[model samples]
Target: MRWFGFGFNAFGQIYVHDKLIKGECSDAVKQVKVISPTELASHVDRSDCCLKTDGQIRASWSRRASLHLGGDSCVCLGGFGAVIASESCGISMKETPGCKDAFISELYLTLAFPDRIESWDLQKKEKTPSWSMEIKTESSGPPLNLPLVPGGYIATKPPFYRPLSPQLKAKSLALSAEHAILLSASGAVYTWGLGSHGQLGHGDLTSEEQPRAVEALWGMPMSCVATGGWHSVCISDGGDLYVWGWNESGQLGLPSRGLRKAPQQQSSQQAATGDLYTWGWGDYGQLGHQTLISSDEPQLVEFFREQQMRVVDVVCGAWNTFAAVVKEEVACS
Candidate 1:
């Protein structure tokens, strides 16, 4: 399997080894933006260490970290030539290999282990974790008490602790810098929080103080949902991908015009053709379109297709995107 990254490389967050700008000396080029999909090296500095395909890749505004697939260690790369490997810290990731099991913020890296949750303050540069807590688990089948994932329960940050309606059972949850999205067990999608850019998918740019159902997708049974800085996307059981919200960077995969307050028009919707696609926020080339031009509509990242590789999963950082792909096997007739 191979990993491809596109978007902001100002801090080397996307892992491109080539010079970002030509003619300008390497020392003179401060930031690099890849307008197209670029292959990423297994190691941040193009070192010999190999990264496993199943590892977790997490991105923040100016930093990127990847956890080894075995949950043994993680490598972090940051702006200004900052490279840190957590292997020496002796922090065990044995039970936190899942991508969702770890989270990275502007100043903190939190890992959800089977027995506890540990948080490290990146800015502090402390060898010991700033704080940690043991998780209580019931002895039995399926590990009764697992780390908090997007599900029936809701976890809030700071002053925003809105609860879901009593009757609504959430199957998954996604949160952005301003809004939140919930996928109910029944396949109904609900949203709340900041909606200035219409990330809530309520057909209006009104911030919802409480969780509200997205009437536009009322009868559509969605299987998965995701939210970006100021945009939202969901996948239908039938394999259709719907997108909405801020189009300034063409993250919605539509013709870039301006701010959009609703879901894309029918033609703008993308069908899940088993190919990796991206749009919007390409100022940093996070959309993987190969050109600095931000796409207002979903565009197939042809790099993978050209290489006969099938993308298995994708993760978005505040300013970058990483896709895990494997070689497609051709059946001989």
Candidate 2:
């Protein structure tokens, strides 16, 4: 159960202390914490918080608001100031949605939410966090991290794949500042969350709070999907690319500041899809076009075809567009 801390030095969040009284970690030391895992376990909840980087205060186990520990509480779990342990006979964790947006390292399981994240130790040969008692908290934030675990690689766990929708198989996912989109295995597209710019592809400007299938592209199996700062893009199986949402930076691969006329809503056709299209926020040349003109519609990038090349894949970051392609022989060759 060794914990290795390596990252930027802007913060002292990874510092560990040897003096353990069952409380907060001290950042007075400049070295990484290792050699022992018990002290780390007792203070793991404190390690995950970035807000308390000063590290001067020690957490008391006696606080009524804190989790009650029992003799079996050799293992501890904490996140976002809330903690529940095997010794805490009052807590049960079965009802909450399991942790997503997290990473499982060799010795630690880091569950990251939007603002903060916490880590739980995986006890391979030690005491496991008992799940018999359900854990409850006063906070309304979504509780994450399910199934107290033993030390092992995340890949070795018993199959944990659960379907979001029994009928729809998700093929790909993309997220913007406040919205997200999902593509189904069968090529049906679903978009939800802040739809002010028509990023949801529902044909009008409105936000969606839940997953809604994009009716405009029904039956057209999408091979690829991508998103940037405020826009979204998807490629159909027929080698055509579609763009939507905020185009302030030409992210949609268009030439001006207006949305392209969406084609008449037609059912999808079964065709191979491949191509790179970008729109929205092209001030950084993210659209991949040679110029810096912003666009509101889908435009084909001619650089690849003009040079006898074929695109394998394309990805857009906050301000840049990257593509992977296979080069084709030109007539001169």
Candidate 3:
């Protein structure tokens, strides 16, 4: 398997062979911005054991984490070309065998276990989690779940929890910088919060104080939904993809005449045949187009296709992108 990365690398966040000293070199000499797709070393420890993403790839502003080997191991990378072992951060997948996933951020590393999600603060010396949220394992739970709020969805302070809107049983939830989206069990899509960029998919740029069903997508039976900085995308049951919201950089895969770029906003997809495509903000080469030119339309990332590599999965970061790829097997008659 191989991995490819591109975009802002000022801190070596996307992985570079040499260690980067912030102030030691000029901006041009630093080679901080990668304007094309480049191969990233598979082994973070420089060892024979290559990093694997058997499960998922999660990213933060300046770091990336890959969970592999049935979640038994987690490999983390930062801008300085250092690999942080899970054990070093008091995260032992072996001890907590139930750990199924993880989330990374600028200040926290969260682990999702069977019953709860624990968050550890990177700035603190202690390895204990500063906070955690309980995850209901069973399909049945308190009827009233979280409700959409101004900046995000909220559950009342713990110990004295208050559940609101019991009727809305969301099967999946996604949160952007300023809005929230939910997919109900019936496959209906609901959105709320900031709508200045029309991310709510309500056909208007009006903010919603409460969860509002996206009428445009009514009866479509969306199977999956995702939100970016200020845009939204969802896949219908029939495999049709729907997109809305800010298209400044053409993140929505729609025609955009204006060049009002929205940094860190982009979209990507892996085709059924294993091809990968990216579009939107490319100022930092996040689009993997080999050029620092933003595209309003989806462009095929030919590197993988040219090398006979099939992209199995893809994940986008704040300013970069990562793809999990494998060599395609050839048949001899």
Best by TM-score: 3
lDDT (Cα, 0-100) at 5 in candidate 2: 20
Query: Residue 213 lDDT in model 2?
Result: 87
The alpha-carbon deviation from the true structure for residue 173 of candidate 2, after best TM-score superposition, in angstroms, is 1.7
Q: Considering every candidate listed, which one attains the maximal lDDT?
A: 3
Model 2: per-residue Cα lDDT over 134-226, one tens digit each: 233326433333221111112212232222554555555654546767776688888877888878889899988778988888877888776
lDDT of 1 by residue, 1-333 (tens): 677777777756665344521333366344467666666674355342245666657667766666664545444444323433333233333323442355666666666565665666656645666666655554632332111332233232322223456577666778776677888779999888899998888888899978899999999999988888898999999999988888777777776657354556444445445588676666666777666655566667777777788888788888778888888887999
Residue pairs with backbone atoms closer than 3 Å in model 3 (clashes): none
Q: Model 3 over residues 1-333: C-alpha lDDT tens digits?
A: 666778877665566443343234455345667776666663144431245546456676676655554735544445522333444345443444455666566666666666665666655655567777675655554232223221223321222122336577676677665787898778999988899998998888999978899999888898988888899999999999999998888888777777534543544644548888788988888887788888877778887777888988787887888787889887988
Query: Per-candidate TM vs. native?
Result: 0.76, 0.41, 0.79
Better of 1 and 3 by lDDT: 3
lDDT of each: 0.64, 0.43, 0.67
What residue runs in model 2 are displaced by over 4 Å at the alpha carbon?
1-163, 258-280, 287-311, 325-333
Q: Candidate 2's C-alpha lDDT?
A: 0.43
| Root-mean-square deviation per candidate | 5.6, 16.7, 5.9
